[model samples]
Target: MANIKSAKKRILVNRTKAERNKAIKSGVKTAVKKVNAAIEANDKAAAASALVAATTTIDKAASKGVYHKNTASRKVSRLAQAVNKMA
Candidate 1:
């Protein structure tokens, strides 16, 4: 428990931000998993489409501060590479 009023407000604000971050992370993970599943199934078309969606999701997460821009770019790059390698 935080004694100071400001401390209590900070705790609440922090919790809210954490939840938002968690949701964004979850969406990103789900998007990545979808791409992986498509790759594993050897569905090239599906994988390509999934990669686009995943890239968008990852970029949004990075823009929202859930991930660094370079980190997001790397993730998108790897996924795109895997999809391209399938070609």
Candidate 2:
């Protein structure tokens, strides 16, 4: 649909970025789910480990612009609090 060369290039680039963002978001969701599942199981040790992995994944996603820094921080904080409360 893009007739201009530059526009065509931009379309391709945008498509690639969209795919990358989608993958990152999916990974973040999976990480968060793992933490939640561990918490629900009442396994403090598992929850703690999951939290660490989730935190790292979230921070990386934020750094890569997949998520806002404050949003990522808030998620990490909530997950940490849940894990702490389980102890």
List all candidate RMSDs to the true structure. Answer: 0.6, 0.8
Instruction: State TM-scores per candidate.
Output: 0.97, 0.96
Report the CA-based lDDT of candidate 2 relative to the real structure: 0.95
Score residue 28 of candidate 1 by CA lDDT.
96
- Candidate 1: give its CA RMSD in angstroms: 0.6
Computed on alpha carbons, the lDDT of every model, listed in order, comes to: 0.96, 0.95
Write one digit per residue (lDDT tens) for candidate 2, span 1-87.
989999999999999999999999999999999999999999899998999999999999999999999999999999998899995
**Whose lDDT is greatest here?**
1
Looking at candidate 2, what is the lDDT of residue 58?
95
Clashing pairs in 1: none
Q: Which stretches of candidate 2 lie over 4 Å from their true place?
A: none
TM-score of 1: 0.97
